[model samples]
Target: MRKVDLLDELRSEIGVVSDKCADQVNDLYQFVCESLQKKMPGYQWVSIYLVQDYAFVLRHDEGERILPQSIPFGEGLISVAAARGSMVRERLSGRVEVYMPFYRGHHLIGVLVVIAKRANVIDEEDVSLFMELASLFETKVEKYNS
Candidate 1:
């Protein structure tokens, strides 16, 4: 499928997420991880890591999980996105991971990490869509947490 089609499919999936689920952020993360992994087989790993006490703590992950509980403040791709306050995509050989920083208002709170085996799994447009999804996730959090 084309990138737009894939993204639209994801958008449709997430669009139906009841606003009530926002209170359970970990559950919300799991739901999204399962949804994306099932819909897009190329997606090898889907996870969310929150910035806790100056460290990137692994909050949730789905499928073939092997990441540590916490990583150094400025290590790995997730850290790069957090430090730069923007999205960062890394490509190596035939695998790729796109890290997008998730914000709680103006304050950066966490990072959304999407991994795929295919070399061309994502592009600029997809990054934009993913950012939209991240914003949606944050909105849900804000509504639920308030």
Candidate 2:
């Protein structure tokens, strides 16, 4: 399916699911990881890292051991996004590293990391969709935590 179609399906799924908070978040995270991995063939790993106080905790992941369970705010991709509060997409020889921030109002909630097997695979459209999905995840998590 196309990216738009995939996103639509995910949004529909999100709409129908019961509000179980943690379960929903996990489902959403998995959905995003799977969808990106499938749609972007170059993407080898997709993960969400949530910020808790001074740390970025790995909430979920797809693909190989591309991320640690947790890292400091200024250590890796997670910290790059957290510190800048913006999306960072980098192209390496055979991998593409992307970091999208999850923010609610002015507070930064977390970061989503996408690792592609090839460089420059993450485009503008992908970044846009990732941001939107991350926002949705952040909103739900914030509500659940409140």
Candidate with the greatest TM-score versus the true structure: 1
Off by over 4 Å in 2: 1-23
Compared with the true structure, all predictions reach lDDT values of: 0.78, 0.75
**Backbone clashes in model 1, listed as residue pairs:** none
lDDT of 2 by residue, 41-145 (tens): 667988888778788898878787587888876797677777788888887777888998887778887788988777766777677777777778777877766
Tell me the RMSD of model 1 versus the true structure: 2.0
What are the per-residue Cα lDDT tens digits for candidate 1 across 64-139?
Answer: 6646779888788788888788888988668888888888787777888888878787667667877887888778
RMSD of each: 2.0, 2.8
Best by lDDT: 1
| Each prediction's TM-score versus the true structure | 0.86, 0.79
